[model samples]
Target chain A: MDLTFAPEEEAFRAECRAWLEANVPRGLPSGDTRDGFGVHLEWERALYGARYAVVSWPEEYGGRGASAMEWLIFEEEYYRVGGPQRVTQNGIFLLAPTVFEFGTQEQKDRILPRMAAAEDLWCQGWSEPNAGSDLAGIQSKAVRDDAGGGWRLSGQKTWTTRGAFCTHLFGLFRSDPEAERHRGLTYFLVPLDAPGMTVRGFGRLDGDEGFAEVFLDDVFVPDTDVLGEVHQGWGVAMATTSSERGLTLRSPGRFTATAARLIELRRERADPHDTRLRDAVIRAWTDAEAYRWQTFLTVTRMSAGEQLGAESSMTKVFWSDLDVRMHELALELLGADAEHDDSGWMKGYQFALSGPIYAGTNEIQRNVIAERVLGLPRK
Target chain B: MQFAFTDDQLAFRDAVRDLLARECPPSVVRDAWTNKHGRTDTLWTRLGEMGVLGAALELTDLDLVLVFEESGYFAVPEPIVEHVAVAVPLLPEPTRAATGAITAVTSLEGQGAVAYGNSADVVVAGSDAGVELLEAFEVTTLPNSVDGSRRLGQVSSSGTGSGVQIGDRDVFRRAFDRGALGTAAQLIGLTRRMLDMTVAYVSDRNQFGVPVGSFQAVKHHLADARIALEFARPLVYRAAWSMSEEDPDASVHVSMAKAAAGDAANLTAAKALQCHGAIGYSYEYDLHLFMKRAWALAAAWGDASWHRSRVGRAIL
Candidate 1:
């Protein structure tokens, strides 16, 4: 029933708030763009130097080994000061957790420090032209080259976010031809600079070079680059996708900060008499607060050793919808000017549009919630 | 921060839940619609005996909300929120000890209809001026509500000066917040019950030679309802904690909880009815019990729009 942070947690929060307030860069470009990605990487390096890059990881891995609660507090402080979106999230949030869980000691030592320092930027390679929602329908294959002491990968992975800019990728590939759908897959860490690989950057809906199609023509990945056991990538990939969908990727502090900004925006621009818009702002703000408390409840359960499984789908559906609605309301407040303005509202609105579509479509998440959380019959 | 109930608090909730399951089933709720006093006396006594009526005096706001939520789960035909959360807390020490006495509350200046006013042993009228405990008051029963079990009445002082001033405006405001928080908890319970019934119904009933729950459309509808409840539940609990800690922002937090819980309950009821089809439309089906309770409770202390306005004033 305790809701207030402990004294030490408060001290940690104060320390984070002071550091973020002092050092968070201003006027940084969108991290999704080519020019912006480079600047964002510099910011990531600055964060790493301050030991603020991976607060929840062990100290040996360039983190403070902070608790989950402290991690949430750090996120709160980070977003409260308008910290730039983490350019290293794919490596730090999504892939790093899986690597820590499943990676061998050699893999952890090699991958983690570089990841924290943003020395080797990483992007995901999950969705393809034919395998968006049906992720297990991956057509990518990794054939063993026993004599060469490696695997030869051949596949076309589309919608590989930031793949063109990233130095490395972590993805699933079929390693056993006879096995089908979720079996016989192996997780691989591939370098974009491999001899047979080419990454073609493309414009997303927001017109940023945030999307890339990675074409692999027998690109070789050494045996040491294998993430987990052979033919166990499906299990390994599920762990990463859950992190993608859950609190690790989208903490409540992000939305609450946006909600606070929305309130300030209303105070500055909106008509005092516009009750309709006022109510909408309140709804958005209240929902954001609700998400905050819900995250607290979740972290509390996790701290108590409860496993978060299919329920993360519920969190995904909630925040993705909330993000879109909050941004939509901001646009409406901007009215006609929204179409031409560069206030980042338009950019944010465009980015929020992708929340439901990526990290598994809301439709797919709903199916997961219905079938798994509610125990509803599946077709 | 730990955002869960303690074992003792949870045990209390389970005990209340079990008692309601045995004593305050749907049939008993149905009975209230036709019963003489619009309530069953025995269950009230049982609740009082269980110290539920005195929860505000003993338990923290966090523990007290669980009782209110369980009462909502059963759709109990009693003014537990009014009597326990609002009225009893303001009573004089000796009066507070009389747990079995039914005490309803209403705004003194607004003088709106009081829930369970006609049947209550006493009515606490409150406003910025002060709080007054009325021993006997004139009561004019209002029109029958959408929820038949929820009987409202207009209360006016009979001029015998039996009304004793007990507390001041600040105390009254806190009581109002508690009432709002308790109602929010109840709305959450009602929302859960409706979603559960709809889930069970869809899982067993077949249409097009397959279980209705097998349909993606039905699954999505139910999932949306579940998502609404899941997010709303924590807000309610956090509000309880805020109130328990007497945070300076407790009023706004309570407003957030009420608004979110109200919206969740309304949305769930609509989706539950739509999924239940014609059976839910009929009074004969049990789903309407929770749906109707949700409707009344959501709009009772303050509707979603009203609470959102309160929140907007604070933040915007």
Candidate 2:
């Protein structure tokens, strides 16, 4: 029940804050635009150079090998200092865990350092035009290239986050077409530069091409590119999804910072006596603090070697919904300027709309919660 | 830092759960509704014997949190929250044993009725001078509340009995926060029970030739309720933890926990009742027992708006 940090964790936080205050790039691009995307990539490289990119990974992987609590402290300090969003998030948070868990020694030794340095920007390829929430409904296929000792991958993965700038993608493909859903799929990493591969960027709700449709037309991938056993992609992909929804993707620090900003906005622009706005502001802060406490609880358990399991679905539902509500409250506080203003609140409002839709829709997350956490029968 | 309860705390929880399972069954809860004072003296005596009533002074805040949760889960008809979380902490040790089902006075000028007011042996009210403990006979009692499990009464200032001034404003403030935090924990426990009941019912009951639980609408409703409860649980526990540590921000944390848990518990009651359909509406059903308890507890201590205002004052 203790909330106080250990001395070492506090020292680590101080170090992180000191480094961020000294080295964090100023007037950097927002990463929502094409020009800013490159600057964001460079910022990630700078983070890697400072050994602050992946705090929880092993030192060999260019991380500090910090404990989970220290990592949380790093985040708290990082966000407090107004650190830019991690541009290498897809590579660092989602895919890196899978690579560490399922990649061969050769793969880890080869890919992780490059990933940490932003030399090989990565994007996820989980959903398609037809397989949004129903991930197993993916029609992507990969056939073994016996002559070349590789596989010929052909698929169109839509909603590929950061696909416009990423040089590589890791996706699930139907390796054994004869098998039923989720059984015969294979997890593979493909280079976007491979022959016959094209990335067509799409505008997101925030009017940014951060998301793209990646088309793989018989792109050749070596056997070394396979993440895990063929026909066992679902199990491997679940690992990444859990990390995406559960741990690193939406850290409590982001919401805490956002909540602090919302309060600032209310104090600066909102009427002091407006009880409705006051209540919403308070709720936003409370929800964010609740999330922070919950994450602390989660980190403590994980530090003690506990597995999070399908309970991550509940976390996904909670933060995603809270993020949207917080953003909405920010907009409400903006009042008439909510729609027409060029404030950061407008962009955040647009971005918050996608939280529930991504990492599996809230609807799908609920089904997962109901079936796995509550032991309810599947529909 | 560890957030999970220790083995001893868990054992205490299990003991409370076992006691409630054995003594506070649905039949017994239903009987309490019809009793003269809307609660059983035996249960109160057993609680006192178990030292549950004295936990405010004896147990750590975290331990009392686990205890209060079980009280809420069982929908215990007694004024345990008022006794353990509020009165005992404000009153001195010599008077604690003499107190029977203590009720709170949030405002001296308000309706002045407290839960189980008629049954209380002690009426503790905080005022400008100090915290005062008056005998139940000192305050006029008006019975019949929305929640029938515990009797409620309106009190007036003119009573014949002399009062005992035990503590000051700070002591009373801490007791108030404890009462709110206790109610928050109870709301969370009550929400868990409501969600569990609905989950079980939806799985067994079929509609349109399929189990209703399989329907996304029903599942989503239950799922939202579950998410709310899950998120609120940590807040309640952390609030307890904060209070146990005597953190300066403990009051704010308690208010946050109360606001979140009250909103979540009310939603759980509504969703559970809606999922149960017609059967849930009947007084004969067990769902109403918890539903009524949820309504009562949500308004008790400090309601959602009251707590939210507290949070706004602190943070905003």
Candidate 3:
């Protein structure tokens, strides 16, 4: 199907382009830091204050109440200007949506405004060292703190991205040791200010300490902080992970930008009819461009409220695989220069390796396709 | 992102499956492959009558990927690609068959008689001149070593009219590209069939009181085969589609498809054979039927490395 924006949508895109031209300041801080988020927070708050908080959300909850297609245009522009990723990602992308569907009025009132303003930064607490894909195997414990009118939690959360800097975390803990693996868990919003909370940096494949190993000991939470119904954390957790899959991936246009850079790089070293070199260029272009196209399809599907089911898995698989293909081309085209470990091409190659592991590994995705889509006999 | 095949395609695929099952049945494959210098002229005529011979070729462009896919599906026991791809499509079809494989050549521009000792039945060769020299007449050639099941004959050149010759630049180029694409598609078909057969076999065959397919190692390897098949499907289809559309990118796509298809076929067929173990290599087993097809297809247009280098040269 053709993928041109509608006339009205195109007009909306132009308007957003102008607005982004006016906003999105130059020379901003990078990485996951307080200062980095400070400007990001101010920017979001300004947008939110102007009724641009949640493009697809209901106006009742600090949002523009826009259509999904319009929201897509907004996101497209955000990435176009090299705008900051949603700094309070936990609130905007994950928790708020869940809360909007399931939270009480008090929870909504107390949380929505602050989240919109970036006054609070939130990290996810899903994985323990033991429970990544087998998430129901959580080892974290949360005892009823009746005297404090809530709960006291104790646990270690690894791969807690941005945990060291974020002010809050949304987590699922084992609130009832006697309950079943999934049924016993309860979702909670925990503030880092709570006693015995510690965040320690950990190295990631990306060579950044953006992720942390967070320790929570005797951390107190008021009754109001509990999210959704107790022992039903699995459902909410799945929702969060699926949302993360949609929102956290590098934008398709990001690859477009990379492709532009590549075209420039190849220009200096290439000649027409250099078959090997030309072949490499075409392969690179196809892999990246196709994946980018496929991912854009996924985005459009999500906006249309279509459950891609295993197609979503297919998308995840495609981007990672394509990234690897692109990296291979980058290395080949670079010739002798590819040997440099610090080279951008090399870094891309290394980074592409994580693709299959995260957002569910390719093996896992294939399994999903086999079972859910292909209807292959599991045996 | 969307992998749904349309209803029309689904029906078309179903028809192909049925035809292959009945006409290109495993028994037929067994018979054809077991003998030396084998052929099924009757079946080819039947397929041609049904228009299935050109089912994959689009009228818009000389897209041959469709035909290639069918060849892969059935592991069809013929040099359909070479005939349809390299000769009929590239040169003139129904070029006069001579008593022997050899005939006289009017020009040296063609791949010299394609018939060594005996003359070639139909020799469509490329020339530097704008015109492709196609000669057809009653020609005969000496028999050569039967490398494949099909009988081998050699064709020769002399200033004679034993073989018919026609001059057409368009036909030669179209046929050449089609031949390459078709061979690639046939390999894709063969490998796909091998993988399917292996999957079905392993799922049924038991060891240690369990189906072999249930084993993790078996599943992973089968998965690998499936991956190979999938990775090349788009390549094959895109190339075919390009030819059908006569897209400027046809060569690029065709080269990739041919290269990918060759590798996938070779690797997947070998792996499938391994999964079937000793039985696969035995003469009586059905695995050889597919394997031979793969082997033949690989050598038909170009081998894997050749296509790969071509792809490299084009892209790099």
TM-score of 3: 0.72
For each candidate, the DockQ is: 0.86, 0.76, 0.10
Interface C-alpha root-mean-square deviation, candidates in order: 0.7, 1.0, 5.2
lDDT of 2 at A29: 57
Could you tell which candidate, 1 or 3, scores higher by lDDT? 1
lDDT for model 3, on a 0 to 1 scale?
Answer: 0.64
What TM-score applies to chain A of candidate 3?
A: 0.83
Instruction: Write candidate 1's Cα lDDT for A296-316 as tens digits.
Output: 999999999998899999999
Q: Which ten residues in a row have the lowest lDDT in candidate 1 chain A?
A: A123-132
Candidate scoring better on DockQ of 2 and 3: 2
> Clashing pairs in model 1?
none
Go through the candidates in order and give each one's C-alpha lDDT.
0.89, 0.83, 0.64
lDDT for each residue of candidate 1 in B1-316, tens digit (9 for 90 to 100):
8888999999999999999999988899898988877787599888878888887777788888888998998999888888888877777763543467655555444323588877777778887877888887888888987788888888877868658898898887788888899999999999988988998999999989999998989999999999999999999999899998999999899999999999999999999999998999998888887888898888888888899998877888
Which stretches of candidate 1 lie above 4 Å from their native place?
A: B93-98, B101-112
Docking class of 3: incorrect
Model 2 ranges off by over 4 Å: B93-112, B156-162
In model 3, the runs with Cα more than 4 Å from the true position are A1-122, A142-153, A175-197, A205-207, A217-232, A235-286, A289-307, A310-350, A361-379, B1-6, B54-68, B79-175, B179-188, B295-316
